[model samples]
Target: MLRSFSYLTDHTGFCGTIKNSPSDFVVTEIEVTEHSLRDTQAKSLQKPMEVLLGQSSPGLCAQSCDGGGTPVPADQGLRWAGDSCPASPCQNQHESKAELKPGLEDASVLDSLLGKAVSELLNKYACDLKDVWKSKSDANAGTREFSLGPILDKKNRADLHSAIRQKFPFLVTVTKDNEMIVKGNADYRELCQFVTEKETSDFFKFLDAKLENSTFSFEPDGDKEHRKVVHHFINRKFGKLLETKSFTVTDVNDQQNMSIMVRFREKGWSRKRPAGGFQEKQDLYTAFTLQKENLETLEAISFLAAELGVLPSDFSYTGIKDKKAITYQPMVVKKVTPERLKEIGNKMEKKGIRIHNIHSACQHLRLGQLKGNHFDVVVRDLKHHSHDSSADLKKRISEAMENVETKGFVNYYGPQRFGQGQNVQTDQIGLALLNEEMVKAVKLFFTPEDTDDPVNNAKRYFLQTEDAKGALVMLPEFKVRERMLLRALNRYGVNHEGCTKGWLSIPHSMRIFYVHAYCSKIWNEAASYRLSIYGSKVVEGDLVFSEETDETISLNDKVHVVTAAEESAKKYSINQVVLPMVGHSIKYPGNKVGQWYHERLSKDELQTCKFRVSPLQLNIPGCYRPILKNVQNLSYFLEGSEKGIEIEDNYLNESKVSLHISFDLDPSCYATVCLREIMKCDF
Candidate 1:
């Protein structure tokens, strides 16, 4: 889709082109430091009790509560008291059944307070817990409630409740007017079953049985959202029990989905503590400054991973820099020694990548773990307006720069987010993934356009003959995803399952790119519409982060919607107004802008609620982005001969001007979008 740019400043924009060469677009990441992290942690510790207690707020946390008690360590496992082992309600119900009988004290207390018949019924209900869990849906399986007929004596109810708690710690009990209510925790049951099944089953009989010393992959049977939920459930409940790496994978339906590979962690893994108080000490991670020219961040990392003999997932960076740029950023690698990295750095330097300033870090770098990026861009082949002299042009450009510095520019995502050329767009593939049209997404991703490259030829060959092995022979080694997918197709057959297995073989980050690009498209359009309609006005229902909130916290929990009273009182400024990126969790504006979001989403056959892909375990819990971003340290100058400059053709001579511009943007802000505002021309 063609992107529309809306400007916040009314000043006329001059025409220019950026990123003519790799050196022309320079980027330097402003990385987060130990001091900043300490400050953030301190602030978090100081949060009000109410905010800390209110965990249900949007974006506060995704994992469900473990029922408000000390979590049992994974290694300790659940212990069943011998006395509490109850007989199964039906002997032939299932080959294996859970034993959930009350202890002697529990039975005696219940029998004395509520009679033998009532106690027997409770025991029978508890015995059927396993069957109930296996039969119920995820939503209903999470919790089960049982109501005991009301007893007149309050003391007896209290005694019964205490006895049940001792026998079944997973059960929560409450008494209301002598009516004792008992509820079973699903997470508790799941954990117990997981441990029991693993212990009882033959180690050599499972799919992961042979993977004793290596990570074993597990593909949950569900959509993306459901998969994600399951992943979180596993992480929260069994994190100590297993070390897992979760990534996007294609399912049998050829749809983007989630899968996790797990391996047994060392004994007492959960007991290990994180580095505390920023004390200088040796660490497992090596942090270094990485400088690269004309290479995408992932491409450089992939090359480095090959040279280092490590997986790409072992390395982490603060952000993805522009592919066609001289960029410097901090990168962290786990378990790799600095000395070893320095050895590889020499080889990498020949490929336009340089590593330096290596040091030990307590933790690995995460995406967006940076303050912002400083840009030194050179806008070349500037075209002046008709009849405008160099002086007039200079004057216009200066005013435009000042206008942006004061009023800011619309924070639209850059064109690179959507991919280049007139072929298939990344967002199109992403939309297909979101719409659960896996076949279409797969085709859009793997099916080559009418390009004459060898890779395209290979793809065409594969499509025509369904010969993955033949295509693999012709495809270049650098075509990682293509080669990997073909191998999977060859092994699994050229079918839906094979296609999904092919996606699973590719890197997780690459798979997420398409979905994120789709979100970026919606964001860019929404931002344009916001600026076009509001024109820097902060209206009622406009969302803004609270004054005390850190802008770095890009979640809905800290977001506050402007009330009519707040708007009338002029409490928020235009810069504070933010727009949603279209997700299931975000709140839309209450006015026409909000209505427009729904309408636009509907056009794509999407709703805010449908942003989640349950089968793929992808949850697009959208976050808010500022509609306007202030230009920091903005400055510019024009360069070029007055006569004219020779164009690329060498024959055509045009009066070309180059505008050298420099600025800093907050992390996640697109410099190209900012340039679009100054030049007022699509690159």
Candidate 2:
């Protein structure tokens, strides 16, 4: 089979070169030895470009002499941008543009150089230049076809790019346009090896087209075989797409500036220590704190630690909350030094930030956490309302929660919301980027063979966006996953690469496991899980015996809740579970009831309601239908308070976010569930 190879170039430069190289336009004259479509090497070669330049001004050639006597070629005006070519290390020193083309029109020369670079790159990669051009021509002549193989997906692309960066950094180009240009360099050569190992060439073609500001969409093709081939290549290189490790810290104390210890499960090269590997299950820890100074922002004690040098680097937080409101989150820090830890404590005290506690942990948090966020909000300003208004609001909230199976909040933009009205959009761009990253990770693990190819075939299994619109749109599924990931990141933010927040963490001695379930239409499927720490299998039937409901079965209720495991058990280290809640109710007239959340539902502020502190239930739109649901939904179990109000089996699913709270004498006596209820108070 004839392999097709192509290269894109600056349009103006391409036109000039095509005009001058009529004789040697085919592959025979300009030789190409490599077949890599991606960045393979970083050598700065300027030979082909030199030849192209000579074709325009023959007088500049060394052979341009008169008579039999040896004569030197006249210096035609043409300046070299830099001193010497980056590719030729031992050759002549590069000439200055002023010296080479002092009198030549500069603009035209720039145009020529652009085209020359493209031609040079093409000849360098396409050993059989004639075959590549013919293939491209055939593609153009045959139905204007383009192929959207799986490799173009965001996740796969990210993986390929990451590999290129690690293996061949110099070949990568970061242009103002965000377009990655791979000139001849070590990275470029590695990319060729990476793609060739995948046993496919389609992805390379796509990358080549992208380099020229074109896309696979330009010549649309429907044969997915190429995509599958690329996918196989990706799978061969990367294993599991979504693999994460979590650590539990036991010595967490908000008061002492102690460090929390943690480790990983699968193991890999540690950014903190190069000596670490994937086999020995790494072990390390850091010191930090999480505080809800404001209702919106959950500032970490490690923020100061990073400034003071307690931890190795700043840290990584999942999300940034509002500065005006009080919030709580999780964070993680990598390795830290003792001197840096003391400095961190001093800084926190100076800044009036308290360190709650620290503990030893077994691993680093990759994603997911215990339950969801518990939001306690206070709404100011009051209007004339009957005593029943609170009760009605509560009722409405309850009904609304059950009906949607997702959580929602008042249109209060938490600093991240971007759109407006019916078109209101959230911080989806960030979510989209995360999804792209996940896809890339999957590709990287499952298809290491195709590490260099540009197209990411693994995207087909997950949600994907178009070529130009990627990293901008977040599907509902991605959004939900992102929320959980963000929570974990925030809770354990630490000195890490490419993270937003510094280091942060959460301390909890008690451990519990919740089964994350999914429901779609009438059928629901739950994937089995094993002990994260001890590697033991857990069965759903062993956890929940059975549940009795009083109300008539509704669409939401129609979904079966197969108790996978106990909500709270010491044996399980997993903290939270993700479940998809959906109701058959619509926006219009229905038998469904609703309630007001994040606010006191009724004036019965004195009424004591008993509730249990079940895990927080985060409700998000169906992965397929997010736009239909305006707000990201979340709810949790607020069973009872310390006062012990007689609680029913299910008070109100809508009012599930509220639970009574009380403080006995010490702050340690504070109950997370009770605190949740108080936060919902209208006061």
Candidate 3:
């Protein structure tokens, strides 16, 4: 069955073709980082500074003296000066001078100067600083600066600088207005000095040692534009290892003005602790950027796993990339060394896969961990109306692109969400599973289609002859899921229990993918119905996220139905409207659209409350998705047929033109759906 999707733009979209060649489509993943995850962790770690310092009472500072110093009220602004307290009147002044004595190496001095909270946080990484100073023979040992997270008080900042200079003579302090930077002085090497555009390889060599937790600083020789290129190059090469931060530094030749300085250090290096002290557990997963041409994400990972003698389940990634396109995504594997993966990757160059930027990751890659995907798509063989000239066609295409950018597009799951081929619809198997018809689902899996592929032929042979062994012979080796199911059926016989076993033999991800595809189909139909009935207006029955809804909240808990008063007041915009993916726990719209969901579910002989299957352990509590998605950084350019033809012996006619469109979509949004809006044709 063909699924119809609605478009947000009203422009008459022209016909254009995509995926003429694998190179015509390129997808690059935008990754999530530790800095982004910190916001999610902030709410859980909400203890006050005094609590971290182990203070018995609130507003009491931890003392620096051997025996606990006399408790002074926090309002007095008086602190302990070790043993040299002359009197209460001059106690504060005496404490400051005594604490600033040269060669004073007490860690408590840091607590007194920067407050108990900041001192404890710094102490957690004190091992990193101590290691640098201890390693005098190390070439990479150098001055390392740590940011004291924004201090707005002028006196507090000045106190921090003075404390570092006097108490710790080996350390130097500088202030960028209100922010204090504490730098540890040690022997350093100029790894790459005055690096020009042509000498990027030297910079890469320096980055190669970054994995060993080395720290170094270099100033690239360039203007702003050239430096920008160098920055991009560094990110592309050493993104996983480099903990990059931009700061202003006085120019080496000209001290009057400041220049942009980028600091590079190994990720998570600062958090290391001294030997036998409390330390973070080493990461079990190794993540790397997997770049491939004409290979599915799983297929590439499976190939690598097979080469490395590991299970395919050992690898994880944020999302699947297109099989027929050049794609780059981050993938992680548990207990695998970067060296082993790199060795296998070097051999995979001939197989259209290249892996790089390998590093240790604290956790496995999870779905929806990426910001989004950036697509560079080339649409060829553009057809024009008979009345339109080349210029007119280009003008219309330009207008369509602008309309898509301004009005957005329907956020429908693309056809690829459903498995390829017309012989068996993946959603049918999903529906059978939900209904507890395991035998029926298994039969559907083996259902013969019109396609003449070898896999289908094997399925037909197996169904007609009941010969699992024979079918296995004809099936390709790469069809792991099919082989596993057949093997299970062969051992258990094709009965109810056997079919259940066969279905369970498939990977959990693949099984869940089928059910999600069914939910996506329902969502696509409901979204089209909504646009047809209610145009672009925010209706009273529509659903929008509540004011309390945010990234930290669970998806199922974020739904809020639009009320009549709110709709009248125009509180929610059309873009804010969302549709449920249809589940037992999901709440439908309050109007005809909600009723439409019931009718649609009734047609399938299913109920919203029946999404859970206890025997199969499949509990799909569906989530809400936005009905519309906006395009970011959308731009397009027209190319003549002869200019952009990737395949030399082109099949397209001389009149054919290519439209190169580039844009970014948020996570879980499909680029093909956006292309459907631009072309007004099913992909």
**In candidate 1, how many clashes are counted?**
17
Name the lDDT of candidate 2: 0.25
- What's the number of clashes in each of the models? 17, 125, 0
Q: What would you estimate as the lDDT of candidate 1?
A: 0.64
Candidate 3 per-residue lDDT, tens place, 1-683, comes to: 23455678877667767888888999999875556654533421221011111111111100110111343333332211121121222122111111222322466667876789977765544447656645766655645567777777765554455444444444445554346676653311221223532233333333221212122334523366655654565555444334342333446675533222222321112323344432223335688999999887777876787677776777877677888799999888876887888788668887789998998665466532577899999987777645445545655676788888888998887776676555678888888887788888877888888888998899999888877778888987667777888898888888888888887787766776778778888888999999999988898889885433111223334456788898899888888888888777667899999999999988888855478777666767677778888999998766665685443332334356677889998877888889888777777
Off by over 4 Å in 1: 1-3, 41-45, 48-284, 386-391, 447-451, 549-557, 640-657
| Local distance difference test scores for all models | 0.64, 0.25, 0.64
Q: How much is the lDDT of residue 412 in candidate 2?
A: 15
Candidate 1 Cα deviation (angstroms), residue 651 = 26
What TM-score goes with each of the models?
0.63, 0.26, 0.62
Better candidate by TM-score, 1 or 3: 1
Badly placed stretches (over 4 Å) of model 2 are: 1-139, 142-289, 295-313, 322-327, 332-335, 346-397, 403-412, 415-683
